[model samples]
Target: MSRRVLVTGGASGLGAALVTAFVARGDRVLVTDVREDASVPDGASYLRLDVTSEADWEAARAHVEEQWGGLDVLVNNAGIASGGRIDVATLEEWRRVIDINLLGVVRGCRTFTPVMKRQRSGHLVNTASLAGLVHPPGMASYNAVKAGVVALSETLQFELAPYGITTSVVCPSFFRTNLGASLSGSDTVLQSIARRLIDRSGTTAEQIAAEVVRGVDAGRPVILTDRPGRRAVLAKRFARPVYEREQHGFARRIKEAAEGAADRSTTKDGA
Candidate 1:
């Protein structure tokens, strides 16, 4: 069965890749993003959207309804990155991250859940990062927002199950994307760390997108994209003390490296 799908952040990166993949699968997909362009591939519709705004969502919904009657799949893939220590991060920055990464999904659900409920058979996929399950070194705001997304997705899964609407939460480790480049605007410290993490992480946008489509096809409620993430979650559940100890040591090592770089700067200045 072909699905009428709507994807947020569909102009670039993982969203773009997902949009393309869905189209290839013969699904009618609506791609929405803040930037409008002619680059969207053939057979997929494109719409301008600012996920932060209610008016934009309303318009997009209207467009989807006019064309497809109702959506079968809603992929809440729009998100932003946040970095830096919690103590040093600005209130404005925190609000921006939360509004886009967390509230954006909330708003999408609020607007679309009723539509899906009326249809009584639909699937929702929310993109939460591996950061949602286990906090990496310094991404306090990103971790909080993504963790919220994971919780929200789980709650929706149970609540919507009664209505025959399925929900899946995707937790991808890392991939090459402009996410790190954008994070640099908000926090150089976080951007630098993001660059390193992406360099070391496995999986690609296409691979994640394939898994997402498969999970929806399988009616899965939670989808972890990589083995390490699954292992980390299991370790946290079965051996929490060991996981905490290891996480603490990992964090300490990152902090030590940052301090070491500062010491090098001091030495260079003295010379």
Candidate 2:
């Protein structure tokens, strides 16, 4: 049976990888994104969707209803990258991030819940990040929104289960992707760290996508997409002192790197 799957932000990066995976598996996929050039994999469909817009979500629902009759899977994967210290990131920036990252997913869920409830069987995949589970310093907006995603997914896992629905929140560690292109933050220190991590990660988006698919198929509630993230979560759960130490060390590294960047800037200005 070919499942009806809809993936938001399916133009590039992890979303694109997921679209490809679904297509390869003979699923009927609707690839949606706000971008005009949202790439649709072969044998998949495409629709323009801005998760921030209620109208767009409604249109998506209509499309699904008319095209597939019902949706078996909905992947809320649309979000921008952000990293900033609490005070460094302005209120406007915080609101913007929350609107798209958190509220966006909220909109997607609201749009599709009725459809799934009627069908009495569906799966929701919400793309969060490792930051959602473990809060490293700097990335307040991203961390907060992703954490909200985790909470929302968990809530839906319970709320929608009665309707025969399953929810999975994907918490992927740093992976090689163009997510950095959308990265926004006033804190240069954290922004640089995030960019570097994304650029240097050994994990590819395809790897994460495969893991996400497996986790979803298995009906896992919390899908940690990488080994390091899994270990971090385990440490956080069982080794409190060790987790605290690691967090502190990571924060110190950010501070030292910020100081180094400032020193280099000063030297350049003096010259």
Candidate 3:
């Protein structure tokens, strides 16, 4: 069935790819982002939205309701990653990450779920990250926000199941895209984390988009885009002991690095 889909951050990266895929399939897609340029594909309609603002969400809802009558699919894909240790990160920075990545999805759910409920049938697709499942290093803010997104998506899935509304949270591995390039102007630790993840990640936006289309078609509750994502989830689940051991090892490495820096300072003083 052709669906009316609203995709946040649909102008670029994974969102753009997903919009293209859906449009190709003859779906009526409304692509929205904070900045809506002429770069989007011809078939997909463009709209301006700042996912963090309530006003923006309200306006978007009104616009969609006016045009599509009601939404069949809401893809909450707009998110920004922040770097550094939890303690080192400022409260404002933490809130900013939460606002865009976590609360943005929450707001989408708050508004669109009612529309879905009215129709008694609709799908909500959220894009999380592999970091949400695994305790990765140097991306505390990003990981924390994504973890919340996953939890929220899971909860919504079960809560709305009685109404025949489906929600899918997509946890994607590192993909080949300009996601890393955009990280350079960001904070130091965050830039480093972005480089490590993007450089070592092997997935592609196209692959993620294709998997998402398939998952939506199948009405899946959770969409893991890469094999590594599945492996990570398994390691975190059935092989919990191993996952914890690896996390311990990672902590030790950080501790060792800290100790090495302290020792270097001590030697310099003695000299």
Candidate 4:
């Protein structure tokens, strides 16, 4: 059966991949993004939606009601990245990240839950990160918001179950995406390192999108795409101290690499 699906941040990266996947499967998709220049799949409709704006969500709901009558899937994939030590991050910075990454998901759920409840069958796919499950340094704000996403999704899963509404939290590791382009904060070196790692990683947005489809089909509450994400979740569950140690070591390595890059730059400049 063809279902009505909506994906936020559907302009690029994983969002675009998801849009393509759903469209290929014959689902009527509505792709929304805050970017005015965001692209939609050939058969899918496009809407300008800022997840942080309640009015935007209302407009989306109205559009869905008018066009599709109701929605079957809502993918909260819109988010921003932030990197900086907790102490160095300003209050404004924290609020900005939280508003978009955490509160955005909140607004999405709040807006669509009632609609889905009325239908008694709907899926909510929220895009979180592995950082939400296993925290590392220099990403306090991002980690916190993503973790909140996971928590919200988990709680909603229980609350919405009786209503036949499904909720899944996607916790993926690094993949090739434009998330780096919108990163905010003082961790330039860390961001550069992360960008390089993601570029070199074997994962792709299409691959993650496939996993997402499979997970939703299977009604999985927690969806993990990459090996690192899977392992981290396992370690965090079975061996929390071990996971904490690994996170600390990873943070140390990033710091060391950043320092090494700085030293090399200094050497080249002095030459």
Candidate 5:
């Protein structure tokens, strides 16, 4: 059966890849993004949506309802990145990241859950990050918001199950995406280092999207995209001390590298 699907931030990154996957499967997809210039997939319809706004979510739901009668799937994939040590991050930065990353998901769920409840059959796939499961340094805002998303999705999984609605939280490791474009932080060196790592080692958005489809099809409540992500989740659960030690070591390395880069830049400027 051809399903009606809606994806927030569908213009690029994982969301765009999701749009492609759904369209290939003959699903009618509504791709919404805050950017008016966002590229729409071949078979998907585009709508302007700022996920932080309840009104925008309402408009999106109305569009889906009017065009498709009801939606079968909702993917809350809209988010922004934030980096910097907690103490150095400004209040405004925290709010901005939280509003888009955490509150956006909340609004999406609040708006669409009722619609799905009326239909009594639907699936929600929320895009979280591996950072949600494991705490990393210099990403206070991102970590908090993503962690909130994971908790929210888990709670929704149980609440929506009774209504014949399935909820899955996608926790992926770094992926090759334009998320860096919106990254905000005072930690320039750390941000640069993180960007390089992602640019070099991250998986393609298309690959992650394919995995998302499989996970949703299988009704997985918590979907980890890569082997490392899966292992991290497991380690966090069954081997806390080991996971903490490893995470601390990784964070220490990143901090050292970032500090070294800052020092080099300082020396060059002084010279």
Candidate 6:
């Protein structure tokens, strides 16, 4: 039987790819996003949803109840990008990211839990990041939130099992996508590095989405979408000393880039 699937942030990027994938599989797919309904993929239905709003989530739940009866898969894939050093990033930035990235997923899980529990079956797929497993310098907000997702997903795997619910957390490295458009941070160098990585990555959203589908279908608990992401997690787990060394080197690069930015400003001022 075809599954009833709902994906948050499904208007574009990885979420759009996911919708297309499920639709291709003959599944009944619903695409929800902050964007206009017109932007939803061709084969999937669209719903105007802002994950930050509880009213929106409640509406989504109601729509599922009225339309699909019960949902088989819920992809909590909505999030934003953020990066900066400790001193450079503001507390307000921290709050905004926490609200959207972390709290957004929390809201999604809570809203749909009752539905799944009533039906006695559901799967939750969360989009985290490689930074969640291996934290690098700069991007404290993003790292923290993604890590929270990982922790939450794991907890739900155990907590929701009795209700016939499964959870999968995705940790994908930089891929070509519109995710960078949402990035906000004070550290120019860190932000530039993130943009460059996104622009230069060979992996595409479709590729990551495909991996996610396969993982979810196979009932995998954790899914790493790219080789770099898998390698990074492996290094962090079994090669702790090496991982620490790489982290230290990355920290040096951040420091040097900051100094370079300061020197350029000083030169421009003097000129």
Number of the candidate with higher TM-score, 2 or 4: 2
lDDT string for model 3 (26-125, tens) is 8999999999554777677888999998999999899999998999999999987566656556778888888999999999999888889998999999
Tens digit per residue, CA lDDT, model 4, 1-271: 7889999989988999999998988899999998776667677999999998999999999999999999999999988878676666788988998999899999999999999999998999999999888787877888899999999999999999999999999999988888767775776776777777678878899999999988988999999998878987889899999988987897898779778978999999999
Q: Which stretches of candidate 1 lie over 4 Å from their true place?
A: 185-187, 264-271
Selected candidate, larger TM-score, 4 vs 5: 5
lDDT for residue 134 in candidate 5, whole number 0-100? 83
Select the stronger candidate by lDDT from 1 and 2. Answer: 2
In model 4, the runs with Cα more than 4 Å from the true position are 239-242, 257-271
Ranking by TM-score: 6, 2, 5, 1, 4, 3
**Worst ten in a row by lDDT for model 1:** 181-190
Q: By TM-score, who's the top model here?
A: 6
Per-residue CA lDDT of candidate 6, range 1-271, in tens?
Answer: 6899999988888988999888888789989999766565556788988999999999999999899898999999988889889898989989988998889999999999999999899999999988788899888888999999999999999999999999999999999999887776677788888888899999999999999999999999999999999888899899999999998998998889889999999999999
What TM-score would every model get versus the actual structure? Answer: 0.94, 0.97, 0.89, 0.92, 0.94, 0.97
lDDT of 5: 0.87
TM-score of 6: 0.97
Report how far residue 25 has shifted in candidate 6, in Å.
1.5
> Candidate 5: deviation at residue 90, Å?
1.5
| C-alpha lDDT of candidate 6 relative to the true structure | 0.91
**Ranking under lDDT, best-scoring first?**
2, 6, 4, 5, 1, 3
Candidate 1, residue 41: the lDDT equals 85
- The lDDT per prediction is 0.85, 0.91, 0.84, 0.89, 0.87, 0.91
Q: What is the lDDT for 56 in model 1? A: 92
lDDT of 1: 0.85
Per-residue lDDT for 91 in model 2?
A: 91
Backbone N/Cα/C clashes per model: 0, 0, 0, 0, 0, 0
